[model samples]
Target: MNRTDLGPQRIVCLTEETTEWLYLLGQQHRIVGISGYTVRPPQARHEKPKVSAFLSAKIDKILALQPDHVFGFSDLQADIAAALVRAGVAVTVFNQRSVDDIVAVLWQVAALVGCTQAAQRWIEAVHAQHAAMRQAVQQRVQRGARRPRVYFEEWDDPPITAIRWVSELIDIAGGEDIFPERACQPLAKDRVLADPLEVVRRAPDIIVGSWCGKKFRPERVAARPGWQDIPAVRQGHLFEVKSADILQPGPAALTDGVAQLHRIVLAWMDGQVAAVLGQGGVAQAGGCHA
Candidate 1:
């Protein structure tokens, strides 16, 4: 019953990304427990016992599971990792804030479970998807289509903008993140908008809200003070992308997340053309169609 040769046969994932990644790599069988927030692969929710949330875990429950290794994400989980280590459980916490870091971490996780080849193949598909999006965006730009100014709201209250990986995905999806500078900040507190009016001043063509785990209320955002003047509000360009899709720093972000973004940007482009044709004037960017 020696386990070292099998590479972490019993694993616990304290976050959605690692759980989803392991499931994608066909290593879900090794997972003994998962974060309660995992929703990427719906089956995971039913198949695995939920042992942890983002910032907290049932340590006693986890211990009972006897996981050989545990995976977590970010410094937010540092305390959880520390406690696990103290109990002699091997813990690897990945702080992947950007797209490249996410890909690299996925590779490392796959390697731990002896699924490097599968991970490589999946990573290649992700790269191909990204390249295809980039090319499509380039083609649009060449055809005189303007990239929309995207304001992705990670949290509505105090208004936290997109993270680094999300910002890069916006660019690849043919939209420029209005708060690119702030998105580079690794910490959510640092990325928070000090002044709510800053979003109004930025004049984004599209506003995407993924308010952590809370449902994004478009009416609430549109009702913000002076937000009616903002182009996104005026044109009704506000949309909600589920937090599990875009906020998770893994395959979901790379695939469904970016794909949704691309569709939004493309729809905006089409709206611009329609507006120009209907008005018989120059095409103005930023208008919600439906």
Candidate 2:
């Protein structure tokens, strides 16, 4: 088939990221169904039929929609994608685990929807934003501003740490993910911080919680045994970045989520500069150097 002819006219997004992207690309009409967890645009929940959850889907319901294509994410949705493919439905599963992967998948999605030009424009714009952000942070680093150690908790029970994309975004936003080493682990089991005190040992300057679709209770996190000495807990540096913004692995992560992370990190770095200056240290907190 011609590449243009391969594009889907009716689509189902089994994940929030794709649904949110289509909406941003001005192609939401192509999506006949979306995941129940979609809330980025808000209108998607009311406009599209909810047909899937993160790890499960209503196969019959999806078939009834007669979508020409179905979009899903990660190995977690492998079974769902396999079932749909077995049923002779066209399915594309994107396992984007890193910042670059997210950008690559986004461009591929745009091609699938025949909106490559529009998506490319947005991509180029965000890439410029990335350049500007990197420049700003690099300057701060040269000025000896501390890149706050951040513990981004994806899940609180066993305490899953940052994902690859989130970890990269944190660095871009002027914070260092304390567990960057574990960010690329594909499974949550592999990323789990087995010992709760490990987080305390790291002595993170900030504790960011997303909790994967649940409310992040900073108090609950602070109340954990022996966490009082943790710098983040002691100084009230707890924060919540909504899962919808950071966990989606798409536009929201590249834009809104990143912006939020940057604001938090920059403020902390500025405070470090101020504290150092107050103690008669020579590094000032402004200019291209900060």
Candidate 3:
């Protein structure tokens, strides 16, 4: 008997994004193992045996799987990649910190799994959806609305802001990320909010909490001392977007995540317009949040 090799028959994904992408591209059958954190397609958790976590994996168990290729994400996973490499296992680690890189990763992974055509079609659809959403926001601006000020809380302990892709998505969703500079930094330490008062000072109209896999408790955020005057807290604009929907850096973040963001930001814009009309301020520039 002879076995025909289609590219990378036995694949292990050390991150949720790649696992989710492969499943989306109809290449899930090639996956031999997946990260325990994958929840985008909840069925993945049940169908695939959990073999890895975000920062660690069962190395011996992974070796036992005999994967021909292992895909990981970011410098955070460099140690795992290195260990696998030392054992002569093929490894590819991607550092996709921004929206563009994530879109590109989709195509690259699909190509490896011999599904480039399907992947390209899906990618084009996603891009089209993004463009349509941006256009809708642009129309809103033309009708006397401004982008909302958005603060995406990636972590709550020290109040880390958005990551690169989330920042870009905020712009597309008719909101301006308050901490755009922080998003450029790949490491969370660099993006940490050193001064909690900085958030109040920025005066965001909307607060989106993802909180890195934990339940986002907006009440806790509102209860922070001196946060009473913050516009988002005062106006009851704090909202929670689950990490699985917004932080994966792949289709989930680019499509569903951004859509949710657009809805939230647009609603805020509507509220701003209503407030101006109620005050009889002539609705000049609709808040000019950015």
Task: State the lDDT at 223 in candidate 3.
Answer: 97
**1-290, model 3: which lDDT tens digit per residue?**
11223579889988888888888877788888998877757788898878888888998889999999999887778899999999989999988888899888887887787787788788889889889988988988999988889899978998888988889999988899999988888888888888888999999988888877666777899999888889989888887676777778788888878887887877777774333212211111100000
Using lDDT as the measure, what is the rank order of every candidate, best first?
1, 2, 3
Q: What are the runs in model 3 whose C-alpha is more than 4 Å off?
A: 1-5, 272-290
Model 2 pairs in collision:
none
Each candidate structure's TM-score, on Cα atoms with residue i matched to residue i, is 0.90, 0.89, 0.90
Compared with the true structure, all predictions reach lDDT values of 0.82, 0.81, 0.80
Give me the overall lDDT of model 2: 0.81
- Write candidate 1's Cα lDDT for 2-59 as tens digits: 1224689899989888888888877788999998877768898899999987788999
Give candidate 1's error at residue 176 in angstroms.
0.2
Residue pairs that clash (backbone atoms under 3 angstroms), model 1: none
lDDT of 2 at 194: 82
Better of 1 and 3 by lDDT: 1
For residues 221-282, write the lDDT of model 2, one tens digit per residue.
99999899899888878777777778778888899888878877776777743232112111
